[model samples]
Structure formats: structure tokens, C-alpha cells
Target: MTESPAHTLFSFGTLMDERVQTALFGRAVPTSPASLAGYTTRPLQITDPAVIAASGLDVHLILERRLGASVEGAVLHLTDRELAAADAYEVDDYTRRRVVLTSGESTWAYLDAKPLRPAERIVVVGDSIAYGRCDPQGGWAARLAAAHIAGNEARRRVFNLAIPGSTLADVSEQTPALLPARRPDTLLVAAGINDSAVPVGAGDGDVRPDPAHVDAGLDSLAATALRHGARLVVAGPTWLDEDRTRDYEGLRFTRARALALRASLRCWCEANHIDYLDMWEPLRGNGGLLADGLHPTAEGHRELYRHVRAVSC
Candidate 1:
């Protein structure tokens, strides 16, 4: 693990935004009122939608070096990983510089410095199961994050991109664009169950996906991770109860599709040396594990979180 950062950073821009802070630091950054001499804050319009969505503003505060001017802001301490995430979050227009504060404390401040550093950030992408769509406490993803805090596992932090009803196609089509913005150190993807719900196989009436779909989608996902310099962890689809999905209308067929998706995912992960989690191996035949025959119950989320906890982000 990288050493925790001892450097304190002064924020004069979007880093002050709570959403941006959480996205970068994985926790609320501790801050205190501080001022910088010889600088002034200027409001600038940010055109990047990703930045706007994250910071919830189309305008950002920037510091301009000026004589006899003092800029008031907050002082914050961030881990090395958090610093890297912040660097990635800011656009190219900004740079980093060390400055002395009015309070006699010197800290790192973003100005216009060049950016590049290692990161330990993670993003979770998947459907309702990954989103904990039914669980009030936010399901397994939240639990996994909580576990990290309890264990002092600073090597990994998460940003959830999961959406209810998202399919592998959605992941393949959308993740490439989102990853660069999040710039996660790793991407843990849980999908394919919804895709398998579609018809497939040569039997009388099948709705499962063709193996080609899985292959193509996985290929795209893998490539997206590579493009962002992120490692990929592919988790198999969650186990399901037939009673919840159309009262076992096509139980065997759905099961087969799930199996095929898992098999293909397993093979791909193994061949690529990527980490893979098996929802089936752990939850199969476990009664009441699900909330609606589809999503996992809260207790079930705890179980899933335990599994996610094992993987090194």
C-alpha cells in the first residue's frame, strides 16, 4: 500500500464541492478556514459536463496570482491516492503549487501544475443487484465501502456507477466514457443477469443471450479498462429465485443462460488474469437471500459485501 499523504492541500476551486470531495477522497475531507496571500479567486465557466455533473456547477472558482490580494478558502489534508484523484478531476487549465497561508501554514495548492500520479480509486458498475435497488441501506456496494472504513483499508475507495435495470450492453456502451472521468484505479463490474433474461438457446422458446453477446461486451469492457489504465474485476451475475421472476416461467432456460454467462466470464477473467467473483458459488440455493426473487435482501447484501471485501481493488 502507498503511504498515507501527510501534505495538506488548500482548495480554491471545485475540490471544495462536497460531491467532488467524496468522489475524490472517498470520505469527507477535513477542512478549516484559511487564506492565501497574493492571489484572487475568479469565477470561470467549465464546459465539461462530467465536471459539471460531479461538482454540480457549470462555473468553478480559480485562483489568479495578484499582488497585495488575499484569497480565502479552506485547508484540507488528503491521502496520496486522494490527491491523485483530485488531480485527475481538475481540468488541464489548472496547476499545482506550494504556497504559504496567512495562518503561517504552508500547504499544497492547485494552480496550473502538470498532473500524473498513481491512484487507488475504484468504481462499481452494474444493475439493480449491484445498485442495491431494493435495499434501503444501499445494498452490498455501501456495505463494501463501510467495511473498508472499518478495516482501515485505504488502498481502495469506491464510486458506484451502477444503475437499476442496466444490462451488459449498457455497460459496454457507456462505461468507456465514464471511466476516464472517474479515472478509477479499478473497475468492479457486476452485470449480465439482465442480458440473460432475454431469449436464447435452440430450444422451443429461449430468451437468453448468445455467447457472442457476452464475448463482445466483455471485450469492450476489457478494452475500456485498459484505456483508462484500470484493472478490471468481473463478478458473475447474482443468483436468482424463480418464484420472483415470472413465477418460474422459464426457470431452466434462465438458469442455463446465467450459467453460460458465468462460464464465459470465468474463462475470460482467467485468461486475462482479472479477478472474478461468483455470485452463484456463494448464494445458490440459499433461501431468502433475495428480496424480490431478483434483488438481494439486506442480509444478503452483507454477505455479498463480504465477498467483495476479499478482492483487492
Candidate 2:
């Protein structure tokens, strides 16, 4: 029998993000907002940070439509070796299931489902970094994906939906519809700096610190992930240098607050059975790790992958 040609992988998450696409695929991908029917999208909880998902609630199968919608994403035409490499990057907590895409024809695609654990799908949601900013290959979310794939060959798939400037309030607002659609396995949440920096309180236009709001948002995200048989991983914010002296009303980016915020997130993760990754401490020492003051460099990504590999091993 003649061998069939390799199939193309359609994505709608972090892989869709520009930088991440370039890093993993060695170039940009052509994409559109493809929607899968009988599913919904949700905010993913990954310790201290949030991601997004497209899950199915009522049915086991997810029917997708490549509507040519102008969403950001890419199409990767894979060879067996490339597929293997991709699989190596998505092994943990995910299984490669083929789905029928709604492009007026049936197309095989990969879906990340954790049947053994029966956990919620893993979603990585947040701001720019979550969106695979500056250092495409080095973003924590991508690193996590690559690590998971390498460790759990048969079951690792993650959907990363990190928008720039996304906040806790945004997550709270977007979660309901997304959860049922994505049916996530876990949620990885990393957001806050923007919220903290925005001015919105009664005072001399001062920035506010509403840990309660942040906590509530996280709680909801966790609950949603758990509801869909998913776990949670909350990652705290990485260090950023927003001039505190400028007294930027509503935006507070200070080292002290960052540490405290991370602690609070860690406490929440522990109590909720969510995994926690401390990006702040690990990425601090060398300037080599950060592309700018905020994002991770290629070396930084490698370091993160090493840590994740260690954990899995």
C-alpha cells in the first residue's frame, strides 16, 4: 500500500501566537479563526497565571470549522519526523486524537485530552508573555508545552490563549463561555501587572492593589478548570520595571508587590491542588534570560524547559 501524505495541524491557541509559531515551526504560519462546533472557550488556570481553551461539554468529539475568520494563528504542514517532534513537545496530560474539521471536508487534527487523569484541559492565559511576546522560543508557556510533549509522548497537548494586557477581570468575564468549549485539562494563569498599574480608586489617582479581586478571579478560573476535569497551575508575574516613583495611578509594579503577589498565588495553588512555577526567582539572576526587563530570552526558555524536564523526570 502506498503511504499517505502527512496531515496539516490546525491551531487556535499559543501556537497561533506569532513569536511562538516562528520559534517552533522555524517560520510563520498562515491561519484564520477556525471554530469547532459543539464546544466553548474558557480561561485556563496554570498556577498564578491564566490561559484559554476550546472544549466540548456535551459530546466527546469536537467538530471544528475553519471559517477563515481573521484570528491570529498558523498552519503547519508536518512530516512524520516533524509530527514526532511536535508530539515530543506535547506528551504530558494530552492525547493525540483526530478530529473532523469543518472546512466542508473532514480533516485530521490533534486535540489535547487527558483521559487517564480525567482532568480538565490545560490552558495558558495572560498578557503579552502569555501571548508569546519578544522571545518566541523562550516563552514559559511554549517551554511548558515542549517539556510536556517530551515527557509524556502519548498524552501532552496544551492550548495557549494569552492576549496582551489580559487581566483577572477579563478572565472572569471570558471564562464561562470558554470552559465548556475547551474542556481543559489544567489552567495556567499569569497576569496582573496591567491591572495593578491602571488607576481606578478613590485617591490622588493612585494605583490600587486588589488582591481580593485577583484571588476571586483565580478562584473562578480554578473552579472552571476543575469542573471540566482539569487541574490548575498558577504562575506569578515575572519582574517588570514600571517606574514606581512616577506614581502611575492604578499600576503598581514593584519588586515587593511582585514577591508578595507570588506568595499569595502560591498559597492559593497549594490549597487548590494547582501546580505552581515561580518564574520570578528562577529568571532573576542573569540578564541573559530576559529579552527585555519583562520577557524571557532564548536562554531563559531553555532554562525553563530544563526545570520542567526535571520536574517530570
Candidate 3:
């Protein structure tokens, strides 16, 4: 099996913009002409401000036809960083997926698939962030759900059982009630911010529910999800914006505490063969999306949706 470049994109569109290529990759990349079998392309409107500014265009190609013909494009070599940047630039109109070119080359391409027609029963179990509290429109979950529905019109039932201040234990406690056992759902969890909190007086040394206990709870959550015949995924707790958290929300946990908790939660997910998304890295330093450094604002929810798409969809 051949490994794809850390990143690869078969661009039938956008990267065609010189400014977009420059802004997204910092330089023009060498490309080879390629054609993808079984797809058709049409114009897709670009709505993201930054993407519009970078591309200097409001429309790009959207591929819909998936059989009997081909779509001509180019194979672009992108650094992982650049690939992520391109993902951000594409916004939600398109999603990247691997494709095999007629020339026998395998690469990635952006496609606007169909929409919702529920196939998998996906259940999200965790905290307030999962509930999209501060995100005016909807949290990442909502955004991801909409996109999932669009991608194939695949009908999906996503049970969002998120609670404010939910510790891993709280999540474990709620699992049986929210998730169906025999039917089996695709379960996702994002908790631990509550357990990792240092509080105003506790400083950063230790948290309320022991971190070990948090891990134990996470383990239990995964076990229960699997026992009930559901697939499990997790978005580990994100890092905080100290100033925003302190000034706005008045929550004062340190970076060290966040890192420690993230490490613990991530380790548990990896060990259990659970699909995981590291929430902190993507959301960090992003201002407009964060309402108070801790929770996502409306735009933040959209941004989270993008990240969620890359990992889950």
C-alpha cells in the first residue's frame, strides 16, 4: 500500500486561484494533471470571509456526479499544515475525501455530497460544550450533524446528551439512559473539563474528582457504550484562554492542568480503540469563535463543526 503525501488534494477548483494558493500554502505548488473517474463538478458559493479574501472569488467547483465519467483536476502536494489551512479555507461547502485518479494515483478531493437520510444512530454524550451552550447558532455537534445529513442526505439520529459541569462520572451515569442498547448508536464523548477544574481557591495541583477517577469513569463510559453495541468516539477536553476564562467566566485553571487532563483523557481514548478528536489544539488561540475563552460563540460552533468534520466525517 502506498502512503499519501502527509497531505494531498486533487484540486479541480480553488487552488486554481493564485492568491488562494499563496495564502493557503505560502507558495505555488507543482502539480500534475489528473482526472478522477465517476464525478461531476459545478459552481459552489464561497461564504467564509477569510476564504473569500484569500481566493478573491465567491465561487468554486462542487462535484456531484459520481458515476460513468470523470472530473479533471490536479494533484497537489501539501504539507499537513497547508492541508489543514485548505480545509479551513474550503469552509463547509466541501469535504475532503481520498480518491483514486484514472492514472492510478491516489489523492484527496473536495466534494459536496448529498444530505441526510439517517443510517447510523449517533449519540453524543458529554458536557455543555457538546450541548453548544455559548454557540449562538449551534455547537460543533449541530454543524457536524447538518453536514452529515448533507453529505449523503443520510438520515442520522444524533443524541446529544450533554450537561453543564458534567464530569466523566456524570457522563458514565447518564449513558444507559440516553443510549439505546440493542439498536446500537455511534457514541461520542467529550468531558473532563469539569473534573480537571482547579476552582478559584484550589490552585492547579489537584482537581475535585481525582484525574484517575476521571479516567476510570471514561473507561466505564466506553465499556458501557461497547457493551450496548455502540461505537465510541471522544473529543478530549479543550484548553482554555486564561484571560477570557478568568475575566469573563471567572474560571481559573492553569495550562498545566489542562495539559495533564488532556493527556490522561487522550490516553484512555487511544487505549480503548476509541476515535478521538483533540478539541484543545484546534480551538486554541481562535478568538472570534470563543465567547469567553472557554466556550464557543456562534462562529466558534461553526469552526468546531469544521474540525468535527475533518475527524469524524
Candidate 4:
């Protein structure tokens, strides 16, 4: 009598343990050294008592996609019954996936059951600061996009639609163009700096943006975003160097006005249950953060990128 055909299983971690094989299959299944392409291993915490006892370790390896990366493992040839037993041993966090190996062989392996979906698209709209006027890297939004959406290493697509000298009203105007024919993913607004600018030669009561108008603009943006299925994030304005800004291009930017706008934006975001990034404190008083009193330096842009990624991304 001839033996039945076998299923191929690729394992980079716990499944390769002889002790685990014996506990699950009653014998050590034969394995051949192999490598999985386009994936790298990450540590996963295992809580199943049986799995821990069988492998004698509480952590296991799972695969995540990384271009040009590879996971070293082995292929096990198992009979139908043994394969079924192997399936029973895996935890819920892992799901079997078909993959091509480095040696031009196809096989099955367990991967993260709930893998993170790559962000489809991200859109940024705001003022000159958002336009990355001074930062060599184009600003915080650009840096974040470059890290996530550029080249083969990219996991998503990012678009910066910010225009210099734009206000919250400008963002509202730009919103229509942002609505995707399909579905929109995320929209980040980084305005209010231009709005807060105090005209150097104007009267005491003349601030550039009317608070009421700012609120209306924000409301319009939020409503449009909700209707379009896009997640809205409002990144508040940072502080300016009052001394230097007092004479820049015949416009005076005051820290006091920036503070007030930041507070107002934060309140608006809170009232609407929206995400708001407060960038004032982190960038304030840092001599090197601001270039020419209004725009952020490269390091400042990096800082903004970090904070934006922490919440918005």
C-alpha cells in the first residue's frame, strides 16, 4: 500500500519546535529549511495555556509584509490528519495564509489573523505653515507622508493640498476637491496661523480673521467630512516669535492671538467630538523650532510629524 499525499506547512517559530510537534502530531513531522519572501517576523504574545505548554514559550512569531524582507522558516510535510491536528493547535490570533517561498515553492503559513489594513489615502489642507514654507522637508505633513506613502516602502498614499496664506475658509473651499468619487480616508486641517495674524498697521481691534467666521468654516469642514466618510483631524496653530513676527512682511503675528486661536480650536474640536492636535506648547519657546519667526525649521517639522503621527495616523 502507498502512503497518502501530504499538506505543506511553513513555520518560522513555535510550530518548528520538536516538543510542539510531538504534542500536536504524536511524532516529529519532517521539515525542510525554507524562507518566505516579502515578509518579516514580529513577536506575538500567546496566552493559550496549551500552546504555551506545548511550545514551552509564551511568545511566537508572526509575519508582516515588508518589501525586500524575508522570514527564515521550514516546510513540514504532513498527512491530512496531521494537518488537521496542526490547525487545532493554532490560536485565534493566527490565520493560515498561502505564500510563495524563496525557492519558488508555494506553501501555507500562519499569519496575523487581524492584520492592519494599509491606509488607503490621507489629505492635508491648511495655510503657509502646512505648505512647508521654511522646512527643507516641506513640513510635518510632507515628512509623515514620505515615511508612509513613498516608493516601495510606502504603505499608503498621502496628498498635501495646503496652500500658503490660506485660512479656515480656504480649507472649506478646498474640501469639495478632496471628496473622493469612491471613499475618502482621512483629512487633516492645519490652519489658523494666517487667520490669527494681526495687521501691523491696522487699528487695535483689527485682527485678520473674525472668530465667528472661523467657527463657521470649521463647522462646514466637519459636516462635509462626515458626509463624505472621511475622518477629520484639526491641527491647531503653533506659537510665533512675537518679536520677529512684529515686522515680517508688514504683518504682525502675536503669541497672544495664536494662544487664543489654539484654545478656540481645541474647544471646537472637543465640542464636536473631533480629533485636535495642540502644537503650541511643544513648539513654543524653542529658539530653533521656528525659522524667520513664522515657519518651522526642519527639526520643528520633524517634531510636528511625530505628534501628528501619534494621533492622526
Candidate 5:
């Protein structure tokens, strides 16, 4: 009779949440902050209350383990049944593999890739959504981690460094620090909404679309991603409501500005050979999915995840 592999799951994303951990594993395992070599974290942009833009340019990767530095996360010791359940739930964009984990011990951990495409390095940079915002259950990026694990049982290490309210400019400034550390296989970037929301000049009316800035940021981000031999995935900003009422806080922008930003982003993605995920139309087209006019409620997030899964698949 064949024996089931005894495995330990190392999680760095939303799985770090105690409740989420318990729900997935049926019991909580001891968790600590751990870092993987050759990866950095950043933010994902979100506009509406319910939906967030998968913005920014922060992602985790495999590299040489540093002496002192470590990424933060929890480790779950898994039973065969629990591991099976986890595998079923995460069978999407991720695949599992073996990695020399933070504990300095080698055990069976879920790495996020098929055959674990070995890269000298890789980076994912974005805003709050990338960082995982209000969705306490660990946001989309966390889910992506799980998917990576389930998909590639051979290599399950992807670094996540998503921060909230991060702009493209922030990515440009930080890319150098991350690129210097490791060479990545894939670089995914999500940005835009914040640029649209920022008030223009001294007065509110001065707020306008800065195509020049957006263009410059994209150029730098794409060059950096390609320089690292990474495939770039650029996600457009999620949809937001322009009309504000006593019920919700909405960005007040003209239709022209909104359309222009969308067009500009689409154009840039196309020109750069970056894989673009258009989250705006799907979220806006579906009303019940959004909790408040902006962010994705639980249901909305699920929808967004579905979208990512489809594209990733």
C-alpha cells in the first residue's frame, strides 16, 4: 500500500489570518513571519467600497535565504484529509513544489507553479488589493497563493507584498530595490485608480487625468519586468461610481476623465505585451456584487477571483 505524504503548509498571504487558517485546516497551526529570497511586496489599488483594483507592483519569489531577513507568515501542519480539502479548494492558478522554507528545515511545502518554473527571481507589485485589504478572509492574492499551491504540488513559494493606496509612481521608485535582489520569471502589476482619485491642483477642480505620468510609470514598470525576464500582467482599475449620495462616498470625476483613463490604460497594456485583466466592465456590469459602490463585497471578491482564475487558466 502506498503511503500519503506527510506535509506542512507554509502560508505568507491571507492564510495568516487566524480564523482563515482555522477554517482551512480545521485547527490552527503555529505561524511566524517568514521571508523568501528574491521577492518584494507592494500595494493594490481599490476605488469603490466593495471592489479594489489589483494595483501596484509587489510580489514574492524564490531566492537565496538572507541571514537576518524573513517574510512574515504562519505554518500549518496538515493531516491527509485537511491537505486534501486544501488541495481541492486551491486547484487553480497555483501549483505545488518543494522549497527550502523559512524554518531552515526541508519538508513538503506547496510551491506555486507547475513543475515550479525555476526563476533566478520574480516580483508582483500592486496596491491594497495586492496587499489584501478589507476582505478579512485574506484577499484575492491570498487565494492566488492557495491556487498556486494546489496547482503545482512541486513548488509552492510566491512572495506577496501588496500595500494599500499605492500608486504607479511608488512602483517606479521601489522597483530598483526589488530588481537588484533577484531575477523574476513573472512580474504582475495593477495600478491606476489612485491616480484618478488624487485631487489635481490646490483646488479640487484641478484634478485631471495625467496621461504623461501614467505612461511614464508603465514604461518603467514594463522595462523592469522584462529586464528580469518576467511576464507582465497589468490589471486595469476596478470600476467606481461617480455619483455620490448621502449613502456612500464616491469619486467625483467627469465621464470624459474616466473614459480617458480606461482607454489610456488599455493602450499601454497592449503596447507593452503585458497581459491585461479588465476588471472594470465585469464589476460595473454586475450591480449586486459590490457592497458599497466601490469595493467588492464578499460576493464581489468571489466574482473578481473567478475572473482572475479564468484569465490565469
Candidate 6:
């Protein structure tokens, strides 16, 4: 009989590899998504021949202390014996340290044996589009995050905080809470479609969000990001297939309204000296890119990802 795995290990590096885990523990350990805040990763060159062969790499990720940053990884459950095996596998350039995960779980991890500094972080906040919606791949934001995972030397951490059915007002209310904990180098606000949507059967009273309030919300978000040393980029409203979108979840979207909002948001971004991503033009006349007339399909998300990657770079 074997005792239940009692040790908790958080890994933001090669220990995440199934091959590495099997070599050390004789099996792949159980793990769950988790993140460590106030830390980042840098490349650590490996000289140990055994580690190089075991992990199939001559370089590995090493943690570095950085304020206003976080590293995404997983929490691995291991028995005491397996934990010891992991310790033996790590080289002198790595040091084991007990740390608290963002979920408040206390776990042991291998951090940089030597101290250093540096990094870039991106945070995306918006509506369902930014939240990925119909896309099974988790949309453009997830693609951006995947691009930076593990082996990528340009490693940029992207955090998507968008929610379905969110509006500028909702983002304005939620974004402030992200501060003091996450100070992203770039902040992407991908919203306004919901704001432009007019409620069905409401006649003339069914109006798009007031330009004044929209401007105020944008200004507030920009100020918040700027104060925290982040560059703000606003992704304007996308084009809608009005023919298929006139009735959506008790609301109605029109081509004219979407176009108006896009133009208004673009002008505001320009006047405010903020970067604006013109999501409307590329998506217009392409109803196939939209699912159910609103949210993007998988191919549509890839299209969106290309535009986002351009500005982010």
C-alpha cells in the first residue's frame, strides 16, 4: 500500500513536462491550473548532462521576483518520495522555496537560485468577444497566452478578464479591482458591442449607450491604466451581420449602430492618444466569421488574434 501523495508542488517550468515527471516520479503526477503572483520567469542554461537528456532541453525556465506580475503554472500532487526525487533532479541553479499560489494554496517550487530582474505583462478586459465565446480554442486572448508559454523567448504573459454580456460600465466597475495586484505593461479593452446593442421592442427609447458616458468610461479606464504605468489600447466595436443579428438574446444589433460606435471609439482613441484596434473593418462583410451574428467563430477568432498580436507587439 502507498500513502496518499502528501506534498504539493507548484511548477512554472520544465517539471510541468510529463517526460520530466515520469523520469523522476515513475508516473505523471496529478496537477491543476494555478498561478503564482509577484514572480516571472527567465531562461536558465543547463550544464548537467543528465538533466539535459531527461528533459530533452539544454535550457529551462527559472523564476525571478518581480512586483506587479504573475506566472501561470499548475499545482502538482506528489508523495514524499516523489518530492525527494524532484529535488535530486533539479540543478544547483535552482532553489526550492515555499510559496503561496494565487488560489491561496501553499506549495513548494523551484525558483531562481540566483536573483535577477525583468518582463512584459498584458491584461485583456472586455465583453463576450474578448471572453472567446463560440471559439473552442478560447479565442484570441488564449492564443496570445499560448504564444508565450514555456519555450518562447519573447515570453509575454497575457491575462484575459473579459466576461460574457459585459459592457463598458461593467468593465469600468471591475477593472479597478485588478490594480495593486496586477500592473500590466499593456491593457487591452475589447468592448462596446454590447453597449451599442439596442433592446428589442423598445421602439425609439431603445438607444445605444450615450457617447458622453462611453467617453467617460474610456477616460476612466485609460487613466487607471496610465497611472499604473500601462499603455491602454481600445479595440473598437466589431461589425455585425444585421440581417442575422436583428434579434439576439432579447436585443437587436444593426449595422449602422455598430459602424457608428466604431467610428466614435476610433476618434476617441485617436484624440486621447491611445492605440485603437480597428476590429470593425476586417470583420465587416464576413458573416461567416461570426457565429449566430454576434460572437466570433473559431476562424473568426484567428482573424481577431492576428490583429491583436500586431498591436501587442
lDDT (Cα, 0-100) at 12 in candidate 4? 90
Q: Estimate each model's TM-score.
A: 0.56, 0.52, 0.58, 0.59, 0.55, 0.60
* lDDT (tens digit, per residue) of candidate 3 on 182-298: 243456787877676664755454533465796789778766765554446677776577666763245465666777788877777666545567788677777666777788788
Encode model 1's per-residue lDDT on 1-313: one tens digit a residue: 7556676889876677777788767778878889886567677678888888889898887765444568888888788788778877777666554456877675777653211111246688998888988789999888876654444454445688898777788998989878766656467788888777743333635434676788788888877775554556788987777655553234232566777778888887777545577777556787588777777888888887776555432
Misplaced by over 4 Å in model 1 are 1-119, 149-156, 199-208, 247-253, 311-313
lDDT of each: 0.71, 0.54, 0.68, 0.75, 0.56, 0.77
| Candidate 2 stretches greater than 4 Å from native | 1-121, 150-155, 198-208, 241-252
Output the worst ten-in-a-row residue range by lDDT, candidate 2. Answer: 48-57
The candidate with the higher lDDT, 1 or 3, is 1
Clashing pairs in 6: none
Best by lDDT: 6
lDDT of 3: 0.68
Of candidates 5 and 2, the better by lDDT? 5
Instruction: Estimate the Cα RMSD of every predicted model relative to the unseen true structure.
Output: 16.9, 17.9, 11.5, 13.9, 17.8, 17.2
lDDT (tens digit, per residue) of candidate 6 on 1-313: 9768998999987889998899888999999899987777888889999999999999898876466679999999999999889989999876565566777666778854421112256788999989999999999778877774433444556688999988888898889888657667567899888888777976645344588978988988987775564556788887778778757689887777777778778888868656677877667789999998877899888987786655434
Candidates, ranked, lDDT = 6, 4, 1, 3, 5, 2
**Candidate 5 per-residue lDDT over residues 219-293, each given as its tens digit:** 888766545434556777766555421121343333345556777888877665355677676677565665445
Backbone clash tally (model 4): 0
Range of the 10 consecutive residues with the lowest summed lDDT in candidate 3: 111-120
* Residue-wise C-alpha lDDT for candidate 4, range 26-134, written one tens digit per residue: 8888999999766777788999998888899898877765545678989998888888888889998775645567886766677655322223456778988888988
Error of 3 at 133 (Å): 1.1
Q: Candidate 3 — number of clashing residue pairs?
A: 18
